[model samples]
Target: MIRASGISLRRGVKVLLDQSEFTIHPGERVGLVGKNGAGKTTLFALLQGELDLDAGHLSMPESWRIASVEQHIADRDRPAREFVIDGDRDLRRLQDQRAATHDDDGQRIAELEAALLEADAWTAPSRAEQLLAGLGFKPEEWLLPVGHFSGGWQMRLALARALMAPSDLLLLDEPTNHLDLDAMLWLERWLVSYPGTVLLISHDTEFLDAVAKAILHIDHHKLVRYKGGYHDFIMQRAERMQQAQIAYQRQTREAARLQSFIDRFKAQATKAKQAQSRVKALSRMQLLAPLKEDSSISIQLPSPTYVPDPLLTLDKADLGYGSTAILKNVQLMVRGGGRIGILGMNGAGKSTLIKTLAGQQAPLSGEKVAAKGLEIGYFAQHQLDMIDPDSSPLQHLARLAPDVREQELRNYLGSFGFSGDMASNPTAPFSGGEKARLALALIVWQKPNLLLLDEPTNHLDVDTREALATALAGYEGSVLLVSHDRHLLRSTVDEFWIVADGQVQEFDGDLEDYRDWLLSRNASARADARKETRALQQDDSNSVDRRTQRRQEAETRQRLAQLRKPLDKQLGKIESQMEKTGERLQELDLLMQDPNFYTDQYKDERPQLLAEHGELSKQHTELEEQWLDLQEQIETLAQSDH
Candidate 1:
């Protein structure tokens, strides 16, 4: 267990915490949350012994090992797997010592081997591989040098290294920042099953709710611990704030009444003694201070002046870099006021599709048609960095709307959290959240009819994220969001476009459905890979003439089609039934929402409706599972034939 007693922490002259106390038990997963620059990182630094407390005492089990993702990794010419494996320092040390030991040193060699076995060194490589894979690393890239990976991939490697460590405590800071939805899901599951205690700093609400067993929030220079998940914390904290507000209001009224009596009676001879007693009581009274509400920003993007019926259209487009097609045969249409979210694995062409739609990159083939008087506002990671650091937010907005009034621009900037001197100060020293706000302000200032936001919430805090979601929800413009933020996706987008297998198509499901599909796809992929390997090994020496092979392949495909006919027919029937069942269930759900549906008069009918609803739901679940299994089987067989 870890304990902090009367701990005072400070950075420079600013005191973040004054005599704060908290206790963390072993195997507890705690989430540390606060506003950006609220000393969350400082607390982590203090725990890791990189910084000392200004006062008081902090203690934990001295023998426990700690693991955390390194912020920076030097460019090294080492295999990625080897770099991850080295995260287990004790195992590496033993291996290194064993390599240098002489044949005569039998005792030392035996001890080293025993230590290696205890460390589970033999399975280290496979464990490292699994960690890397879960973080979106391909099998072929496992042997590549660490220097070959880009910054985001390097961050993934850093996370994988931390996960590879055998430790008593694990500390993660925004582990899902660079990950795609698939990778995020995998990491969440991995962390949930992690045996060690975890203390994570994340702005992702869903991630915290999924993984954190407890929440430690920093409010007004004090640490407040909550007993449950993030949602529970939010609800409980709100209740606490409400009760505190009542107490504070009551105290203020009592103090005012006491003062009023003292003032009125002080001049009267009969009440002089009472007034003096009241004075003494007033002086001794402990007044409760009103709670300070958190400063939350508000964002409202301006609606476009004119929204064309169809904003843009893509016809048989092949999207990618020169000579490298990432997404092929893409046919998509964007209408006014449409909201679409793009979903895919990392490097599976989600960005490519966004870039192509945004006109940052032209399609290698086919046509991209924009409606008359079309305008676009594109926001990506680069957009944040593209803001002039030497200039202020006012200057940036001024550049976009040179003819607009300065005060009006300031007001607009203020809504995005850049108020007063913040709008005038140079952005060079601004934090990431500030820069992101500026970038968004610039984008919204343009009043474009279409918005393409790629990971817009990356540098945003929870408040800002909610504000962005609200703004996007109310904005009357076409939006295509490429993000891993599930809450944002759910709130903003009405439909989903999945970019996978070198193609783009509308997914007939939500984020949860996409997750299940990813898991099923991954399993099918593994089975296909194994089958391919076996077939290749057996036919290693076989060769056929090109023309003869083409004919045979045609015939084989025809035979496979015939074999798939019954399964395809059964799938059609199942899908038709599912569609009808879904519609009927929705009707029943709506009917149940009526005010009089559960009243005494209709109570008899309610049981029948309830029974039918329950039976339908069970039938739907069984059918859905059956459909999934059959789909997987068909896919596996199709892949085997290919």
Candidate 2:
């Protein structure tokens, strides 16, 4: 167990943790959460012994091994797998000793070999490869030089290295920031199964919920611990705050009564003793600190002046860079008020699709039609780099709307948490979260009819992420979101588009279903690989004739296709019904949102409308279940064919 008693930490004059004490038991996965500048990293540094506590006793097991991802890695021509394997210092030390041994030292060599076997040195390469694979590196890339990969890929490599190391405790900071949905899912499974304590800091609520057994939140320079995952912590914290508020209110009433009595009767001879006693009592009373709500930032996207239905259309388009088509024969339509989430593994052309739609890249073939007065608010990581570092948020907004008043621009920036000096200061010193907010502010200022966001929540903290979700939810425009933040995806997108196998298509399921599909697909691939290896080792003479084998395979495929045709037809019918039911639900939702819908004028029609809505909703759910069942069956048949 790790314990901190009366720990007080500071950076210069700013106090981060003052007399804060918290204990984390062995094997507990704890999530550390706070605002962007709330000293979470400082706490991690203190735990790592990189910083000294100004006042406190911090203790942990002296023999425990700790592992964390390195923020910087030397650029070198080292094989990625080798780099990861190097994380195991013990194994490396054993290998080094063996290499330095003389050939005549047979006894020492035997002892070293036994020690190597004890340490499982022989399997280190495979273990390293597994970590690399889990972090989204392809098998072929395992042997590539670490320097050959881009910075983001290098970060993934660093994460793999950390995971490869044997340790009693692991510290992960935003581990999923550089990961895709598939990689994030893989990492979650790995972390959950890890037999070690983990202290993680992440803005991803879903990730926290999946991996954390407890939450350690920084509230007002104090460490507060809550049991269970992030969601449970949220509920528990809210209840605690509510109870605190009630206590505070009761205390206030009592204090006021005592003060009132003392004021009214202190001058009277008859009640002088009582008044003095009350004053003494009041002076001795301990005052509870008032609950101060943290100022939450919010954004308001200006409504577009005009919204055209079917805002953009891609017809048999080939989306990619230069001559290579990452997404072939893509057919998609973005209509006004449509909210879409893009889902895919890393390197699966999700960004390419978004870029193509945003007009950052033209299609190699086929037509991309845009409706008149079309405006797109495109945001990607690269957009942050486009911001003028020397200019203030006000200046950036002013450039977009030169005719708008300076006060109005300042007010607009304030909504994004850029108030006073922040709005006027140059953006060079701003943190990633601030820069992301500014980029979004610039995008919102345009009042675009369509929002094309690619990982907009990457650098955003939990509160800012919630604010963005809220703004996107209420915005009167179409949205195409590409993000790994499941919470944001669930809140902002109504439908999903999956980019996979060089094609983009509608996914008829939610994020959970996508996860299941990915798992099944990976399993099938492994099985196929095993089968291929077995076939390769068989004698040629024992194998069936090539023509006969081909004929049998063709027959099997034909039978499977014949069996699937009816099911496919039925699935199509169900999908059409679901679409109609979904449209009706949307219509009902719009009607219910109207304030006048509950008025006396429409009182008689309300019941009928609600009843219809309930029936449609039930029907939609049934259709969805059926759709998922059929999809699973189709996928099974497809896997069998493979």
Candidate 3:
């Protein structure tokens, strides 16, 4: 359906892509995989004619219409139907003009008729409604103003528009970025059954593996096409790289032997001919490129000073917003060293309940408490907001943690990729990946007994994201996580807590199984919702019950506003501590350099100095334990509410 031959995409001197050759057959489902800046989005733009490639021929059927899902959506005040139909901007504009004026002139009338027929203006509303409904938007929500929705819902509208149009090929860029678990599964099914060709770029590994029949790897300014699933592609790349390494090694050995032969035999004419011929052959041989082996990302989480035995407990817990509660009369006992996954849709009250579990917020009209040793490390989804860009990591840490030594602090920063000069750089200029890494490293450094991570992998590169996941999996403490990254959830978590429309569903299984169950339950949930909506509409009152509706809506919106800040502030303490410790560690390094400094200190201070150091260590550990306990408790609460 689409083909890019010798395609080279560049901006000024920076080459985004170079001579990439690939072909997409009609009705093919292809996963475009690459690193963060490997031009997956840029390639899609070139094919859609949104961006021009530097060189090469891009050929596809002239009649084929292409659709793309843009990342950002602005001006969401219009209704869902109107926003989707607006994709055909010219048609919508002409219709607006026609509605405002009584221009019976032949030129305008004929033009309007032609445009209306081509754009399917009369049926656009029906199509838009159906597409939105299939994407989980309700019939009642069809008329709701888009301005009321959050970023996640706005993304859904963009995707709905993209899917609404009849296109021969679809190019989706991070289409599942803000999607919850259920919505992601629905999209996977749609892609699997879609009639047109699909090219999807996403960070979701499981989603890619589930839907992609072929993998198109964009790497090192070239295209590495593999004709199979994502797993097949991984193995293929590994094998290809291995073979190249072997060939390169063999060639290098031959080159060395030939050079040695030339050095020893140049004086003998007969032997010289052989040596010279070998040199020419070496010149003709193209040097095998250096092997680009995939680098593994590893992190060493700081150990706990004092672990909590019982993380959290809830007896008859009624968690929700206001009196119209969500999960009611529930009992849950969460022990320490727990690893839990909170799964649900956008308005599931997962956050509200989780906060209650953390003891940072209270459950509505219910009894909830935590163990004494509970130290929580709550990492909110938007945790980076607490970090100040103006200060250096060192300065930030010094202000937050007074007891940390300078040399120890630098060592912590070094482990997280901020070695030497990088640690001294202003944090304001840090990329999203760097900031995310700093957040995770900082929190883990404090050695919290329980950790609550909310959407930690959103803007991270695949390598860094997986590293974070790996570290979390290896953590000895308890954990509660709210994330859309299925790979991370599946690999790291053993239990699933699903939060849906004002109810929580707990299941004992891996993420893969949970996904299967969710897909099955989704159809049933839709049917029940539709039936309920119809019954409510029959009443002389509004479409949905006002009290029930307000409670449900407020859980997501109002609670999001209240808790986003405090949780982020709590988690930022780790980075704050790390920065201080780094500075202290550096200071100690300087002092230790002077051989007489330790001897001089010992002369004045003996037991008191040693006692103070012990006290600092004891304080740091106690704080970490409390932070961890709180984090786990909150996470457990999130699961229960879900």
Candidate 4:
């Protein structure tokens, strides 16, 4: 357990924590949350002993080992796997000592080997590989140098290195920022099973809720603890705010009443005694200030002037780069007011599809159809970097709408949480979140009928994410979003499309269902790989007599066919059912588009329609999982026969 008693911390002239006291029990996954510049990162530095507290003490077990992700990687030439293995400092030190030992020192070498075994140093490479795979690195990329990857991919390696360490406590700051949906879900599962305590600082509300057992918030120059996840924190905080507001209102009313009485009597000598008593009463009262809510940014996407049906369409689209087709036989339609979320594994052509739809990349051999006056607003991770560092938010807006008044542009920037000097200041020094907001503000300022957003919430805080979701919900334009933020997906998008296996198809389920499907697919793929390895070994052993080999091969083929036949049949049935579910979902979506379906007159019928949609979605998910299981079983049977 970790305990803090009467701690005081300051940075420059600003006080971050004042007499703060808290205790974190062993194995508790605690989330640290605060607004920007509220000193959450400073608190992390203090905990890591990089910064000293001004007063009081912090205590923890002396024997406990701690591990954290390094923000900098200086050795670019090192292999990624080796860099991760080095995270186990003790293991690395033992290896170094063994390397320095003299050849004749048998006794010392034996001792070192025993120590290495005790530390599980022999399995370090395999453990590091697993971490890399879970963080979305391909098998072929494991041996590559750390410098070969982009900045975001390098950050993933840093995260993998932290997870590779053997420690009693783990500190992760925004681990999911560089991860896609599949990798993020994998990390969530890994953290849930991790034996050590976790101290996570992240702005992703859904992730925090999924992994954290408790929440620690910084408010009003004090640290406050809450008993549960992000949603629980919100509920408890809202209640506290309500109570505080009530007390403040009551005190203000009483103070006003006393002042009124004193004001009316202080001028008259006959009521001087009454006035003096009222004055004393007012002076004795302790005034309570109103509770201030957390500040949040509000985004308002400009409405388009014209919204036509069938805003865009892709006919037999083959999407990829150059001659390589990442996705084929794709057919997608975007109608007015449609909201769709794209789901897929990292590098599974999600971005390729989005780029094709946004007209940034042309389809290899198919036609992209757009309405006569269709306008698209595309938002992607690269868009943030495209912002002119020397330009302010106001300047960016002016470039988009040059005829508009300067004051009008400033007012629009203020709605997205940039006002006063911030709107006028150059964006070069802004944090990632600010840059992302500015990029999104530029996109939102354009009144486009179709919006294509890719990972738009990458650097946004919880408040900004909520605001974005709310704006998307209220916008009259159609939107296609690809994001790992499950909360935003669940709240904004009505349906999802999955990109996988060189094909694009409409997914008939929700985010939870997509997670289950990903797990099943991974299991099936692993089983297939094992089966392939066994077959390769069988092929290599041709030294046996030709007659004997031929007979064995024939028997293996017969047995494998028998084992796979039933599984194939089941897979066919599942595929058929999934198709039906997809069609039904599309029908329901059309029904939902009718304005009268949401009116008071048809409220009674709405629940039945929603219930049917829910039933179909559940069935589709179960079928997909079943299909994956059957595929894995067939692969295992084939390996056994070999």
Candidate 5:
């Protein structure tokens, strides 16, 4: 368990936490949430012991291991798989020790080998490859040098490295920021199955709802604990605020009554004692602070002057870079008020199609038709970079509408959360969220009939994201959105377009259906690869002499059997252990389900039972992973035999 008792934390003059206390039990998955700059990251630093609390003590088990993604990765010519494998520090240390030991030292060598096996050192490469694959890296890319990738890909590598580590606690800050829909789904599954305690900071509400079991919110320099996921936290917090408001109103009425009595009778000798007593009573009352809600953004997308059916159309489009096609023979149309979401794996031509439609890139070999009054407001991450840093939000808007008055421009910017100084200040010092809002503001100011948005909610906070979704929901124009944020997608889009296998087509279902489709497709691909491997092996064998082939096959079987014997034994033992652990967990669940088990009658034994349950759960998760790894090894051997 991790506990902070009345802890006080500060960053320079800013007091982020003042005597705040919270406790996180073992194996709990927690989401740490707050507005930007509200000290969510600072709290992570405090937990890692990189920063000290000014007052009170933070305590956790000394033996607990922690893993977190590095903010910066050196651009080195190191194999990506090897870089991720290094995250397993214990495995690397064991390998190093073995290297330093002499072969003649038989006993020492034996001990090292046993230690390595216990640490799963031999399977580290496969594990690293699996992590990389889940994070959107292809098999061929795994052997490439880390420096060969771009910054976003480097961040994905960093995330993979963090996930590769064996730790008792995991801290992920915006882990999904660099991932696409498929990668994000894979990560959600990984985190859900993770046995350790997790502390995550993310603005992606759907992700938090999927992976977080609890929520830790930072508000008014205090850490507030809620009992469930993001949606639960919102409801619970709203109820709490409502209760507080009621209490404050009641107190106010009482105070007014007391003051009325005092004012009415203070001058009379008849009620002097009562007035004095009322004065003390009023003084003794603990006043409740008025509730202050976070300010919300209100976005109004200017209505288009004209709406035309089939705002844009693509015919026999081969979309890609020069001389290379990503999506071929694509035929699609965007009608007025149509809402379509583009879905695909990373580098699967979603962006290519958008770019072609936005006229940022010409179709390699096709024709695009646009309505006479068609206007497009294309917003991409790169557009934020194109904005001049020296200009303010108002200046950016003024450039878009040169003849508009300054007050009108400022008022329009204010609707997008840029008011007064924020509207006029140079955007050089603004945060990513601020820049994204400004970019959207500029797009909205144009009143385009068609909106082509690519990952527009990447840097937005929860409130801002909600605002955008709400605005887009009500906007009277067509929308083509590509986003990993499922909440935004569900709220804003009505249909889906899938880009895969160099073709573009309409998908028949929702996001859940897409996930199932992706999983099934991957499984089929793996099966095909195995079949191809077998076919090639068969051809090679047919070329050899029949007698020689028989002899070689017999020897290979004997060698493979010898190799599989010990692994089979280990696999059985792990399976037995898993069964036992799972039974115990079921028993604990049954006991805890009894309403009386949590009452005072069983209070003395509850902690022990809960602790045992946590330990068993963690053990079961580790055993399951071992079981999978063993299966993979057996499968590899079988493939080699083929």
Candidate 6:
């Protein structure tokens, strides 16, 4: 366990955190949430002892071990397994020395054996593999050189190494940044079941909601604590704020009336004491200024004109890298009026399939025939690679679309949230999301018939997500695209194509259907895992069996316990959440009341909070039901006691 008491962090004169207090207990998963550049990373650094505090103290068990979800990996050429083992050099050295001795050095052997036992070295490799797989890595990927993977995959590998490490505290900064949805879900499961304390910084709402039991908010150089998940935190924060608001209003009105009376009768000897008393009350009253919560998703999107008719088609398409077929013979078509989504795992050939049709890559021994007179514009996920670092956004737009007027170009970029001083700045300075949007602007400026897009919404905000969804919905050409955002895919794409097992197949449905199928698949996998674990346990209590079977059963039981608690507790948590959500709605109502709606407050924040609550309610209900079923199962298993 670790605790930071009255901590204040400062950089020269600027304070990052002021008088912050937080307790991180063993097995507590905490999420640090705030806007970009709001000290989330800085907090992690402070916790890791990489950043010094200006005041107060941070304390933890002296023997506590710490590991970071390393953002930068130094071992590029090393095997992934080597990286995992080498996480703690002392442990690795002890294991190696212990293995080499064959009764050659009795005392040294004894010492090494003691060290291995203390380090739990016997189970380390297996645990590493398990963690790696949980983080969406295949067994073979463990042997691949870290340098060979993309930046995203490399980050995941680093994170995998850290998760595999035996540590008392895990400090993760933006751990969800490079992960696809599958990997994110995998990480979430591990975090929830993990016995160690976790300090996770992530922008993914679903990840935080699922894994974090407590939320630590860093804002305005101050830290605040809420005793539940992200949704609960927001709701609790809202309710408290609303209560404070009502109290303040009532007090302020009384003070104002008293002041009026004093002002009217201050000169009269009979009323002077009453007037002064009212003024004193006003001075002592504490004002509760509202906190703005919706700054993260505010984005300006431009509406585009739609063109008519089907823009392109793919006939008997085969896409792959070199002679190795990533996708077998595939047939696909996109009509002008409908939105389409391409879905798959990290290496599922979704991008490659689109690339082959767009002429970015050649198919393996198969023809990709596009419709006649089709003008195809392609935006690859690696569009940033195509950008000339030296060119400005304006320069790039001008070079790509020479006929467009400067004002038109500026307007286009502005629509995508690159406006004013930001528009003329060098494209090299833009963030990943900015670069992605700029590339999109370039692709759409050409007015091509068929659009081939790969990972189009990788780093976009929710507002931009909705905006782009609307734009794609109206685009005249057919959209052959791949994106990870379920919300965007739900509105923009009409059908889904799943590329797996060296083939591409069309699945006619939306994201909702995909989610339902995945949940059922997960339930089946969970059942199978539990069954296998039990069989292995009954076979033996070897380290592997104990870890795999006994540990799993224990974890399932723990989850069951949390779910089976009294209904009063469940309803209390929900009602607490409801009060705060009601306050958030009230705040949004105020924002909606404004015709301009351009203030610093969260205009759309309330709606998102409400939707998040619906999800939380569902999860709570499901968990409760699962608990009841598991209880019955446990009782049945113990029937021999009778």
Residue 89 in model 3: shift from native, Å? Answer: 4.3
After the best TM-score superposition of candidate 1, give how far the Cα of residue 388 lies from its true spot, in angstroms: 1.8
The TM-score between candidate 5 and the true structure equals 0.83
TM-score of 1: 0.82
> What lDDT does each candidate get?
0.89, 0.91, 0.75, 0.88, 0.90, 0.71
The Cα error of candidate 3 at residue 408, in Å, is 3.5
* TM-score list, all predictions: 0.82, 0.82, 0.75, 0.79, 0.83, 0.70
How would you encode candidate 5's per-residue C-alpha lDDT over 1-642 as one tens digit per residue? 999999999999999999999999999999999887779999999889899889999999999999999988875698999999988999999999999987555556545665887798879998998898888898789999999998888999999999999999999999998899889988999999999999999999999999999999998888999998999999999999999899999999999999999999999899999999999999999999977677789888888888799999999989998799999999999989999999998888998999999999998887999998999999999988977899988888888899999999988899999998989899998878889999999887878999999999988889899999999999999999999999999999999999999999999999999999999987887688679879989988788998997999999997666556666778899999999999999999999999999899898999999999999999999999999987887776677688
Candidate 1 lDDT tens digits, 1-642:
989988989999988998898999999999998888888989999999999999889999999899999998985688999999989998999999989988555445545655776788889998998898888898889999999998899999989989888899999988899999989999999999988899999989999999999999988888899988888989999999999999999888888998999999999999999999989988998887777779889998998999997999999989899899998889989988899999999889888888888888999999999999888999999887698889999898888889999999999999999999989999998888889888988987879999999999997888899899999999998999999999999999999999899999999999999999999987887688679878987686366667887898898887556546656777888999899889999999999899899889787799999999999999899889979965975685488586
Estimate, for each residue in 213-297, the C-alpha lDDT of model 2 and write its tens digit.
9999998999999999999998999998999999999999999999999999999999999999999999998999876667899
Query: Which residue pairs show backbone clashes in model 4?
Result: none
How high a TM-score does candidate 3 get? 0.75
Itemize residue pairs with steric clashes in candidate 1.
none
Q: How close is candidate 2 to the true structure, as a TM-score?
A: 0.82
Better of 2 and 6 by lDDT: 2
The residue-by-residue lDDT of candidate 3 on 499-557, one tens digit each, is 76666668667777776777677678678977987787787355567897778867855
- Which portions of model 3 miss their true places by more than 4 Å? 10-15, 54-63, 88-123, 321-326, 392-407, 508-513, 516-520, 525-642
What is candidate 6's local distance difference test score? 0.71
lDDT of 6 by residue, 156-255 (tens): 8788778767788988877776666667667777877778889887655556788898998886777888888877987998897788678778877876
